[model samples]
Target: MTDAHEDHWAAPVAAAALDARVRVPGSKSITNRAYVLAALAGAPTRVRVPLDSRDTRLMLGALASLGARSEETADGFLVHPLGAGGSSHGEPVEVTLGNAGTVARFTPALAALGDSPVLFDGDEAIRRRPIGPLLTALRRLGVRIDDGAGPGRGAPPFTVHGDGGVRGGTVELDSSASSQFLSALLLAGPAFDRGVTVRLVGDAPPSEPHIAMTLDMLHRFGATVEREGAEFHVAPAKLSCPEYVVEPDLSTAAPFVAAAVAAGGTVRVTGWPSTTTQPGDWLRGFLPALGASVRLDEDGLVVTGGSSIPGVDLDLHEVGELTPVVAALLCFADGPSVISGVAHLRGHETDRITALATELSALGADVAETDDGLRITPAPLHGGVFHTYDDHRLVMAAAVLGLRVPGIYVENPATVGKTFPAFVETWTGMLGTGR
Candidate 1:
């Protein structure tokens, strides 16, 4: 069972079990938040294990746009703060963020702080994703962002400008657009003289876990935030840190779990700290329910995949990042599977619900989509070319579908870099293949 697209990727030379006890790079979500707050605070900051991925790169660039100096030191990245109430004035610093939702969310807040208008955008696919919730929230909070300067409406090729900087206050949002809305406002919270109290509108505020990640970084950076139901309150605060290390990404581990399930194999992933604060940690409960034999050992996680996943309908409302991986796993389930709780996926890097259904259908799977989510029935899959819609999660999750379907080919294999930069390489190694 081999997919021709597998050949397109230069097989990782050390192709083995990918079984090595390697630590995944820092959570791009956390890395971006930590970097931004550290920059805005402008204190002596030591950030260990910073991510070198596309999203993080743009975040670092956005920080540079705001006049912070961060250099590579011996251990990790050393950030020299721009201090409290710091501002910037320069040429239109064109920030090219390669589809990092966190970067797109947080950088606008940074730009607002400087009164420096930035022409910010990202990967072609990312440009199509919506940022309306944040832009609307920013405007309500007294920041001027013009999303139409770009070719698309409420899309990228946008310019952000703040008049005399921001005047933060109570702003409510219809954040069903993206969790990055709250995360963006949260990360940029310190930059404003008066912090914000956000009342996220709508019953569906997708990806609560990712928003929690933002809050964790907020706390780590020395900002005090309290969450009561749908509201998050933050006082004027600052981010200061001597050292920070990124935790293993649980999202990276999902497709691998799907593969083991498809192939009926046992695999182990190491280098995750037990006290890790990653939202993906919730996977421990969910994946096992899906039928992978899960255990937490001293080194890290060990999963033994079996033939069938219990097609128990689960709510991804709290942890929507895992939606695609979980949707792919449903393809191999024993019965009908319903993945609800995240209709907000429509506005992700792609319309994930439709994207997953469309691409999985192309592979010969029985699937249908709902406004909030989708359902997949176990069906036969054939070898065919799959379209990822340029969404990284869709690309990677579809890869798992391909591996299981055999004879699968993935176009634009480079799309995986948005989150899992080494996805294809590591995934191939795990399967004991050189290519």
Candidate 2:
């Protein structure tokens, strides 16, 4: 793995067509969700092939602070659940979120189930993300949080004073900024004394698929969740899972699949789930629209480049995490492409819409930022530096651009460690540039 603190990395340009088969690591989403569910499970649960990235590590660390320990196993991990009512210790514990959205939004609810006063803090960028709505919902559900940021200001560097139980009930929340707010409460709902009923108001949250993934995992863990329109009710129950197998991360596979499109070749990602709630699965549908041929066969999901990359109009709200790489691909399109319905990206690891517009524009692509997304037009491109703003997805996007455009230097390439720790090596290996 490249050192995340490295100054810059010269992204490798593909000299020939790619015919690579990529085996991405397990999903960070499933890994952390399993960690939280396992910690809340009634028995020790074995998580097989869980992702071993910085975000997952932060989750493990966070769970440990709440008195749940994970024993590393040959295949994955055996998570020991927290004691009833969580740790009885009255002392304070600290959790470092490290700019991970899952850890930042999900861990607080788990902290509310404990007796300790847990202080939640993370990287400077995390402090700027929108977590206040989730925190406010927690307060409504009877969890006391002190950030000194006042009402409606629920950024990190906050303290959750847990009295060992949550008075979970119906709480209205506006999850427009992030679906994590809803998933956070739902993940910990089974452990709540009265369970939780989340009534989402205002605009429907982007990434409805993520909420479905959460519900699916909850069901696998023996929790009963009922959804009625915009309201979801998670019944309080003892959760248990003997073992859970994680699927390969499709989001991480995006760049490699996109490389086939950019460099005019074929790329196959192994272990592609036949059916999944993963938002990355949306790629199979959208890639073809961008003039790529997609097929899911026994080998895996194969993507073959088309004759000419064409511009597309796409609404990526459900799969907004894909914007970075998709935007990168669009930069090489034959015509103009407009991406819409992902304004929520402003609150991600960075302001992705702005970041995409700025960085891609810097690389000579005609890019414009919209209220919710970006409009990208193809132009004669020459790359100098692509600033990643410490966002992992940006690194993947830059790599795709590098496949077609030479001399693309990625800044802080190590930041890809946020999810795909081996991103640099894997990407270079796909292009036959790795030592």
Candidate 3:
């Protein structure tokens, strides 16, 4: 991660309790899944309330490069199947994913359905992230993929050669590294002649809720799927694309929820789904444990900050994306905190554990990095220039810290554009800083 920007954001210091109702955009995860399924569907699919951000745009672009016809609609987007007699047939393509894990990992399976070779590559950080397990599974499924990192090796900058279809069948791989790999395979399962059955061979996948989301979406598209324990079976069937409306992004809503807690105020965010597979929905329980009063009423999920946020012992494996916000709150907690079962966070947009510890310590928090988590002891934090490392979550976490502590300048504040393009506007408006 590089600091290419010159100026830093002077994080707003809250003088009084903030009271606001926020409306966050649609889910990036759901939006990307809708796009992938839409491209694979036999007919055109309409996606409603899709998130318009760097990652989701990259997903749409990658699908478009693969011959999927896309058009902007009043609500969201409409994507046509690859069989629309487009230029992508038998035409080799090179798509730059621009640091989107969904585009780099998920698109390869869809690329395997192409008539010719489709090369998938991404930015510096994308190259460093592992994609070996997915590559290995693709090879077992009879897909001819030339691994660019090395023969039989993973990571991006690779090419997938397709005879216009996949010979997908039973294949096993370890998905503990990332649940996205399993979701990617299942996304392209129905198109295969034999469909696909994926069996997890090692530790339980870190975020099983994500896989659940994939299965639910697959089922909604009319695919036959069966799940028993860690194994998933997808039978051959035609996907009937329907009118889809995406839910609000719970993960992206973390910072705003944290703001209400840290600033000692009441904040209600609209469009909270009544039932969903989003892991960030766990925040309803997590916020209260951190010393906040929570309620879910007719409007939305509302949280009121307490006088003193308390420390907690938690296993954040399923909701590791919330670690940064949780860690930030722990810095101001009443006691010490231990966050465990999230070692995989090291492979995220950045080494999150190390980044959190280093930056928090620089701000005067006593942080000890464990093998799989962090043991944070509270200390008096002072103003400092907190580096973002080009990670969007890190920037938001730093911003949360700035609310209580004056003189905190967050470097690379623009990095939040990855998932939340209107992050600055939304955050500033919610904080009532009007910056």
lDDT of 1 by residue, 1-435 (tens): 233455343222222223333345566777777787787664767788766776676777767766676888775687767533244554465667677677777777777666567888877866767787788888888887777745236667788875546778789987776777888887777656688889988865666677777888788878889889888888877567877776767777767655666556666667656765566788777677767788888888777776577777888887787888778878888899888888777767778888888878887889899867888897988866667767778766776775556556766667777677887766666666422
Residue-level lDDT tens digits of model 3 in 316-432: 999898999889988999899999999989888889999999999999999989998999999999998898888999988987998899888889788888899888778778877
Decreasing lDDT order of the candidates = 2, 3, 1
Q: lDDT per prediction?
A: 0.72, 0.91, 0.87
Worst 10 residues of 3 by lDDT: 1-10
Tens-place lDDT digits, model 2, residues 1-435: 222325888888899988888899999999999999999999999999999999999999988888899899999999999873256578999999999999999989888878889999989999999998898899999999998944746898999998888999999999999999999999999999999999999999999889999999999999999999999999999998999999999998999899999998888899999999999999998888878899999878999998888888999999999999999998888899999999999999999999999999998989999999999988988968889998999999999998888788899888999999999888888888421
Superior candidate under lDDT, 1 versus 3: 3
Q: Give the Cα RMSD of candidate 3.
A: 2.3
Model 2, which residues run further than 4 Å from truth?
A: 1-6, 84-88, 433-435
C-alpha RMSD values across all candidates: 3.7, 2.2, 2.3
TM-score of every model? Answer: 0.89, 0.97, 0.97
Which parts of model 3 are misplaced by more than 4 Å?
A: 1-5, 433-435
